[model samples]
Target: MNCWKTINISRDYGTLRLIMFSSSTVLLSFLFYYLVMSTIVQTTEFTQFGFVTVVLSLFGLVLTHKLLHCLPIWLFGGRAKIKISTRKLLFPLMDIKLREPLSRNVYLLALFSPLVFITTAGAVGSIMWPQFLPYFSILTSINFGLAFYDLVYASHLMKAPKQCYIEDHDEGFHILIKQAV
Candidate 1:
């Protein structure tokens, strides 16, 4: 599919639903990991150098995922920008917007970029270094949980009767419904 016109991003209806969906998914994943996965561990340590490195690298991976989405916008002739700030003790937000509505395929591809990168890399790393499965699994779960929301929102946009409008915001990017006129 293709996007034919410019669209405004909104924090309206569909977005709220996606936020709820994303939140619930993350919460469930965290709970499951804590209650189930954590208990399965046969070994424990307060801190380990290799694990710390893996943790930092995974954080880098997440940032890379965001950059992956942003960088492509410019390459594809769409303008993109980001603003970062924290609202509360735990509320850290990274907002991004593309000035142009990318093709549906591009948008969809971008949505899955993190998942593909994290999961694929983690799978390979885990196989090559079996001892790192715990770290890889933990990081992969986090990225997967987060990407769930974006996938839902992308799906909603793809099904929208109107074109999607994506614009920059002070906090998070807004996805707007295009007017018929």
Candidate 2:
């Protein structure tokens, strides 16, 4: 099947909405760090290695997100495929495409697994490592900020018709609802 033939659902989701949504993600990420880290740790000092640690931590966070998103989708058998789309530029966008459409509930489960685990882990890490608060908060914010796109797609999917299935693309998703026979 030519995947290109499937409908690109992002067009209908509105640019303004996405912009606002993405901006909110970034704002919240920063605010969350400010609120949590500021109150708990008054000051933090970091050397050059701290910068390196932030970079590495970012890479790890993205990998963790991808792993969480991919594992559940792949669990649906071999119908799922992972592809890298350069359209995301330096971020290295990863898309999980499924040949078979899954139920809305299943898709939601796969989508949120990363957010749930990663956010919780970040909170715990931040609390445990007050000395490395900057690093931890930066890593947490980056993870959440980068996940803006995921939140967008999830927003669309959440409103999709019950029978519709979603196929993730780097840019957006294909919402497919089987036409009446």
How good is model 2 by TM-score? 0.72
Instruction: Please give, for residues 104-141, the per-residue lDDT of candidate 1 as tens digits.
Output: 54566667777777667766665555555566666766
Q: What's the TM-score of every candidate structure?
A: 0.62, 0.72
Which residue window of length 10 is worst by lDDT in model 2?
1-10
lDDT of each: 0.62, 0.70
Q: Which whole-number lDDT from 0 to 100 does residue 57 have in model 2?
A: 70
Clashes of 2: 0
Please report the candidate that would top lDDT against the real structure. 2
- lDDT tens readout by residue for model 2, 124-154: 7767766666666666676676677677668
